[model samples]
Target: MKAIFDDRQWHHDPKHFMANGKVLPSPEQPERITRLRHGAEAAGCDFIAPKDAGLGPIAALHSPEYVTFLKNIYTRWQRIEGAGEEVIPNIHPANRSDNYPKSAVGQAGFHQADTACPIGKGTWEAAYWSAQSAVTGADLLADGARAGYALCRPPGHHAYGDLAGGFCFLNNAGIAAERLRASGLRAAILDVDVHHGNGTQGIFYDRDDVLTVSIHADPARFYPFFWGHGNERGAGRGIGYNLNLPLARGTGDDAYLKVLDTALERVAAFGADVVVVALGLDAYVGDPFKGLAITTPGFGRIGAAIAGLGLPTLFVQEGGYLCDELGENLTAALTGFEGA
Candidate 1:
């Protein structure tokens, strides 16, 4: 497999993360790239740097104004008289139905869905490059690669078309699916990340062309509390297109794979030409977040099952914190896919 990556992705180094009523060092750090790179190389993946795709690919999934906001938000936040080092929203609209705000503070709240995604000095450049990595992977898949991996940092499944959240500024999975669809292929995104892929789900919720499905921790007591319920089948033309399979907290491998069997069946029924796996290793048992209990070997089973679908696959990196076996977990999945 060819693994696409960009060194610029390390530029957005987040410092603080608000959790458990206290601000502490964030789990999303630059070291993640080092670990992920080691895993890709160990998995026998050929590393390739992404080219400058410009804003066209990303703009296709994100609004122009929202993209503009991300590019310039850090500079605008720095100019504030008493602004913090990073842009963290202090207030959010009771509902997003209101008009957009003019002030940088209000814009922060408007564009940012939570405090987890703080915009630092190099956030724009890093996020832009991270997105390009995913786009490049899609380009490789479209050009006839059996499979491709995008080592995207500041993982993107949590980002909405216009909102940044959960350390994700740009939705890489959504961008990859969109690019694949533009290449005349029916694309389906199967997000196996521990958290619901709310951003990817929201982007394709109304479109039947790019089918979106997520299997994650039950949202009733999870990070993305708003969406990811099983009943959120797509609406309008997209009805029955979106699928959410939320599992209970502490669910382990055997049970997880059983659910995955059902998810793959849905993909097969959809007749998707290609698949994008929103790969997240945070579901590991030792993960600091403690959301699920998927073992390292379990990831191999997950990968093999996805490969069984026999579709050209794009593995886009999502959330996985600093763990002792982080590299091994990632490599295990890719190895499983290759072996299968």
Candidate 2:
């Protein structure tokens, strides 16, 4: 299998992450690429630097304003006297429907969904290349590869059309699905991340062409507390097109696999021509989040089961943090898919 990545993705080294009323180092670090790359290579994936797909593909799903904000926000924030090194939002509108603001502080709050996605000097470049990597993976599928992997760092599933959250900026999996859809294929995104793919769902919520499904920890008490409820199905023409399987906290492998079966069945019913797996290894038992208890070997089984769908698959990296088994789990997933 071919894996898509760009060295520039290592540039977005975030420094601040607020949790439990205290600030700490961000988990979305550059070391992630090193481990993931080693894992993909172990799985026999040949690495290829992604082409500069430019803003056209990214702009397909993200708003132009949001894209511009991500690109220039860091520098703009620097101009503010006594500004923190990173651009973190301190205020947000009561509702997003409120008028857009001109102040840098208000814009930061407008574009950043939460403090987790801090905009550093290198964020825009890294995010741009991470998205291009996903686009390149989709291109590989379009050109007839059976499967591809995109090692997207500072992962995406949590971003929205105009807001960044949970360490995500550009929704890589959503962008990949859009790329496939534009190529005249029916794309279904199966997000297996422990955190619900709120952004991906939001991006496709009003459209019916692409199907979105996520199996994640129930949001009632999870990091993304506002969305990911089972009843928050798609709206408009997309009604019945989105599926959310929110699992209980501490859900283990066997139960998780059962939920996955349901997710795949929905994808099958959607009559999808291709599947973009929003692969988040954070669901592993050893991951720091501890949302799900999927063992390292469970990842292999998960990969094989997704392969059972028998569709061209593109695995876009999501939310796996640092752990001894991080690289091993990724290797297991890719190899299991290939072996299946």
Candidate 3:
């Protein structure tokens, strides 16, 4: 398998990932890139540097105004008087904030839903290339590769069209799915992140061409509380195309796989020509998030299960913090996929 990656994503180096009033350095520390690269290399996967595919495909997945907002957020921060640091939000609108502020501070509040995803000098490039990696992976899958991995950082599952939350700027899976659809490969995104892929679900919620399915922690107690419930199916032509399977906190391997099996069944029924996996190893037992207790061995089972479908696959790396088993788990998952 080939692995597409960018070194710049590691430059995001966030200060913290907070939970329940506790502040701690992100568990998937900046060192994550090293571990991911190590895993791919050890797996004997060919690696390649990413090339810009331009903004046309990304624009198909994102709103142009929102894309402009993210690209310029850092530069805009420099122009504001009090914006002495990377952008973070202290204020947010109840619904949608209009009469948007000219200040980068106001834009920060307007765009970022959570404290995660602060903009730094490297963020825009990191975000851009991350999405580019996934989009390229999709292109590779379209070309009939059995499977490929995009080891993306500054994960994209949590980003919305107009907002950046949960350490994501662009929705990589969403962008890739758009590219696959544009290339006339009937595509669907199966997001297996521990946290709900709210941004991806939202982006395709109104279109029939892209079906989004997510299996993650239930929103009632998860990081993103606004969406991810079962009730919010698709709207318009997209109705009945979206699916959310929210496992409860403390869910285990068997439980997780059961949900995945259900998701795969739907994907097959949908007749998707290519499957994009929003793979997140954070569900491993030792993950700092600690909502789910899947083991390192379990990831292999998950990967194999998806591979069993035999569809051309694009694996978009989402969230897997720095755990001791980073390499072991990734290697095992790839092995399982091969076995399948």
Candidate 4:
């Protein structure tokens, strides 16, 4: 399999993350690229730097205003007399439908979904390349590749069309699915991240062409505390196109595979020509989030199960933070898919 990546993705080194009301160093570190690259290599993936597909592919799913904010907000925040180094929102509107604000601070609040995604000087460049990597991987699939992997940093399952959250700036998986759809392929995104893909879900929630399914730790008491319930069966024309299978905390491999079987059935029923695996290894037993307890071998099984769908697949990196087994788990998943 071919893996898409860019060195610029390492430039967005975030400094702050607010968890449980206490600020700490961010877990979405540059070291992640090193570990993931080594893992992909171990899995026999040939590396290729992504071509600059430019902003058109990214704009396909993200809002224009939000994209502008992400690109210029860091500099605008620096112009403030007493602003912090990173652009983290301290205030937010009562609802997203409220009026837009002109002040840099107000725009930060309006565009940023939470404090997890901080805009630093290098954020825009890194995010742009991360998104381009996904686009490149999708292109490879469209051009007749059996499988491809996008090692996206600042993982992007939690972002929305206009709101950034959960350390995601732009939705890489969503962008990849959109790229495939534009090529006349029926795309189905299967997000196996430990957290719900609220951003990807929101992007295609009202459309029927692309199917979105996410299996994650239940949001009832997890990180994304909203929108991962079983009842969110898409809206309007997308009524039956969306599916969310939330698992209980600490659930392990067997249970996860059982749920994955159901998700694959739904994808097959959709008659999708391609599948985008929003791959997140954070569900590992030793991961910092401690959401689900999927062991290293469990990831291989998960990968093989997804491969059972017998459709072209693209694995776009999402979560999976720093851990000793991070790379090994990635290798296991990809090798399992290839071996299958």
Candidate-wise lDDT, in order: 0.93, 0.94, 0.84, 0.94
Candidate 4 local lDDT, 101-173, one digit each (tens): 9999999999888898999999999999999999999999999999999999878888889999999999999
Cα lDDT tens digits, model 3, 128-170, are: 8898899889889888898998988878988888888898888
Rate residue 303 of model 2 by lDDT.
Answer: 95
Q: Give the candidates in order of lDDT, highest first.
A: 4, 2, 1, 3
Strongest candidate by lDDT: 4
Which 10-residue window of candidate 3 scores lowest in summed lDDT?
23-32
Per-prediction TM-score, please? 0.99, 0.99, 0.95, 0.99
Kindly list the per-residue Cα lDDT of model 1 for residues 164-187, writing each as its tens digit: 999999999999999999999999
RMSD of 2: 0.7
Error of 2 at 311 (Å): 0.5
Q: Which stretches of candidate 1 lie over 4 Å from their true place?
A: none
Model 1 clash pairs are none
